[model samples]
Target: MITVTLDALDLSALLCSRVCHDVISPVGAIVNGLEVLEDENDAGMRDFAIDLIRKSARQASARLQFARIAFGAAGSVGATIDLADAEGVARGLFGDEKTKLTWSAPRALFPKNKVKLLLNLVIIAVTAIPRGGVIDVAVTGEAEAPVFVLTCKGSHARIPAHVEALMAGTPESGTVDAHGVQPYYAGLVARAAGMQVGFAIDGDTVTIRAEPAAV
Candidate 1:
């Protein structure tokens, strides 16, 4: 497998840029809504502004929560994160998206990095089905050495070529920017956890599987 590495500072900057990119729209919408609330005289317009503010606030919160786990130091090294919590954040992140999440992982606690990898994979899976679809997540085997299988089903579902290249650690993926950083980070997480991630596309379904790295 090809290996990819980046300076710690660069990785952090790219991830931060990505997180900002995800939440900026909603945050900006919230501000716009507030402005409308302040300036609009029509009662109907005021009600619309309030509704927009509420929804945008929720979206921003969800993205932040997901980023906290997926790209942040959620806890002390070696700490464990509950799968149930992971499911909650995953659902939250999917709340406003066309894609839906169906999680089947156990409710037990697993290593922080494992949970991080799962969340990152969820992000990648949802992207496979941009036209709105269902992503079914299943985890099997022991908690410490579990396998993750995410099946994404939707019309015209397909993994992006850049994402594929980044996941494979190929030089052809080019510079790691905000758009490509997440997949690269996901690959890093997998390797850090002593696991390998693979992807396959079958018709309208894309399956992402991760398991113990071959010795």
Candidate 2:
């Protein structure tokens, strides 16, 4: 296995880049819509531009909210986050995506990091099915020791090799960048929470499972 390491500063920088990348497209769309409003005199075009602005603004907000929880510190150390709130941000993030999220986690509080890991896994699962699909998220066990399972089913669903390597902390190359830091960060979160994350592929389905680390 190839061990890849990054300093805290580097990790933070890469994660910031990832979050910015997620929201930039929608923000750019909003800018384009504003430009249309400013330069165009056609009422029909102005109406379309207004609609585009609204949708893009909402998309940007949703991506920011999701990143705030998934990639931010979220709260003071040792704080707990409500699963319901996690669900809300998750649904928001998936709103404009081709994929759909079906969350079945309990409406209880879990450690903030654990919830962050769950959300990060949601992102990984989405990538597995780029052509769009259903991500069924389920949590088992108690709040203090929950197990997160995400089943992603879609046509041509497959986990990228680099993603698998990053999540396993054994990247093929010893370099981590914005494009691959999220899964690396997810691995860090799991380690911090004393959990183990695993991924399995079976035909067109990808399963991501996280549970307590083995003794």
Candidate 3:
């Protein structure tokens, strides 16, 4: 029988905790909004609450879907992501805006884990742009092992350095660094996956790739 080290198990739990901590804010907001709507008595307030609930729900769903891809167990070999639903989730992250999100993927349950990771990463990419812009998300599998790729390009300024290191899994400690410059919890997630993550920045394009562990 193969035994796992305590450190390894602890690291896995720590990573999972990080993922939950990162996602709880958006998901918790949805729950809180729902509670407020259930008890509020004002008509205008109720309408506002409804919008918040919808927005929060979409946000929570997107995070969950993204988590499933990034950290959850991968079930089957070939699965597809629903482009329309994905677009809706992507749009939800941008709030009520004119951001255009174009999803090019088959409509099916592709690999659950891959889809989750891609969704989270894409949302992270889009969130970096505040002024709203066009986003294209695509997914494909390779012959050797399944692979997922996300390419985000916007006319907004270049990708932030911290984010670049986070995607590349090379974050410095906030306390020791000159600035509180560690990547967000999500970047810690990419690192925990034990996958080699890479970032390519050219002109106005920021391409990120998170590949599954090679077997």
User: In terms of lDDT, which candidate is strongest?
Assistant: 2
lDDT for each residue of candidate 2 in 163-206, tens digit (9 for 90 to 100)? 87897778877888888899999988888888898889999999
In model 1, which residue pairs have backbone atoms overlapping below 3 Å? Answer: none
**What are the per-residue Cα lDDT tens digits for candidate 3 across 106-182?**
55544333445555667566654546666677656542234556666667734555665544434543221212112
Give the range where candidate 2 is weakest over 10 consecutive residues by summed lDDT. Answer: 160-169
All candidates: TM-score: 0.96, 0.97, 0.57
Q: Model 3: runs farther than 4 Å from truth? A: 1-6, 26-40, 74-99, 106-117, 127-131, 140-149, 163-170, 174-197, 209-215
Report the error of model 1 at residue 205, Å.
0.5
Error of 1 at 90 (Å): 0.3
Q: Where does model 1 exceed 4 Å of error?
A: 1-3
Clashes of each: 0, 0, 10
Predicted structure with the largest TM-score when compared to the true one? 2
lDDT by residue (56-161, candidate 1, tens digit) is 9999999999899999998998989999999998999877667878889788998888889999999999888889899999998888899999999999999866
Rank by TM-score (best first): 2, 1, 3
- lDDT of residue 135 for candidate 2: 97
For model 3, how many clashes?
10
Which ranges of candidate 2 are over 4 A from the true structure? none
Residue pairs with colliding backbones in model 2 are none
